[model samples]
Target chain A: AQSVAQPEDQVNVAEGNPLTVKCTYSVSGNPYLFWYVQYPNRGLQFLLKYITGDNLVKGSYGFEAEFNKSQTPFHLKKPSALVSDSALYFCAVREGSDNYGQNFVFGPGTRLSVLP
Target chain B: DARVTQTPRHKVTEMGQEVTMRCQPILGHNTVFWYRQTMMQGLELLAYFRNRAPLDDSGMPKDRFSAEMPDATLATLKIQPSEPRDSAVYFCASGTGHMNTEAFFGQGTRLTVV
Candidate 1:
């Protein structure tokens, strides 16, 4: 089975400070990781993805994530947080097995609060 | 901007009533996905379509849920005799190609079954 875990239910960070939302996964094969953000009453917005590339991948709204195969993690990061950055962050992994189908397993989510 | 669009931003209805949610994918995208979101289950993929063909719908309840893409532009998810547990935000996403590609999402339809 493929699964993802977001250890933190919520994260607090000050505006202009660096923020990190942790994510880890368990998969049998190579993983395709993705990060998405959702604001209140809105649909999820894609942040970035790591399929097969450099360890670090940059995404929209000054966000980025680093894929660590050995660590089994793909944590999202932003150097400078903004008050508007407060939202729900989700980490998802596409299962690599053929029988697992082409569905994404999303983490429980982590609420990010960027304080001003 | 080219983005996915969903109808009925909010719907509140009594239980046992029929409910329908609609989505319009991006013009050139070939893949469409339906998902349900709740606090307990973050985002569950209810169904997906590739080239107007049903690819996977294992996440949907076979008894009351049905999804179909009558045309490339429109997709619908219908729940007959919906239950209170069916209340949640349902989202529609579209991707250009495969799972490896990015999928854009709509604002989602908030369904509240009482």
Candidate 2:
């Protein structure tokens, strides 16, 4: 089974400060990881994905994530937080070898609050 | 930009009533997925289709829930007898059906069963 976890239920950060939303995964094989953001009353928007590439993956809205195989973690990061960046973040994972179902297991989600 | 579109942005119904949600996938996408979102469960895959064929539906309750892709572009999820516990936001996403491809999500339909 492939699963992902977002340890923090909520994260508070100040504007202009760096922010990190933690994520970890457990999969039987290599993992295809993804990051998504959801604003209140809006659909989830894809931020980025780590299929197989360099460890560092940059995404939309000045966001990036680093894939650490040894640590089984893919943490979303931003150099500077903004009030608009406050939203719910989700981490998802799928087994690299899974082609039949193409189902993704999503984390419970972490609510990020960027105080201005 | 191409995106998946779901109908009935919000639906409120009394218990035991049938509810149906529809989705239109992006053109040329071969795979479509239905998911339920709630505070407790987050996002869970209810069903999915590939090439207009049902691939997996294990996450959905078999008794009252049914999903079907009537054509290449249209998909529908039906609940015969909705209950209060079934209240949640249902989302539809479409992808190319290739390994590692990202799925584009619809705005979702918020269903409330009383």
Best by DockQ: 2
lDDT of 2 by residue, A1-116 (tens): 87888999999999999999999999888788899999998888999999887989999999999988888889999999999999999999877465654777889999999999
Q: Scored by CA lDDT, what does every candidate get?
A: 0.90, 0.92
Worst 10 residues of 1 chain A by lDDT: A95-104
For residues B13-56, what per-residue lDDT tens digits would candidate 2 score against the true structure?
99999999999999999999999999888999999899998888
Give a tens-digit lDDT track for model 1, residues B1-114. 898999999999999999999999999988888999987877899998888888889999989999999999999999998999999999999887555777889999999999
Docking class of 1: medium
- State the displacement of the C-alpha of residue A78, model 1, in Å, after optimal TM-score superposition: 1.2
TM-score of chain A of each: 0.94, 0.95
TM-score of chain A of 2: 0.95
Model 2 residue B38 CA deviation (Å) reads 0.9
The lDDT, on a scale of 0 to 1, for candidate 1 is 0.90
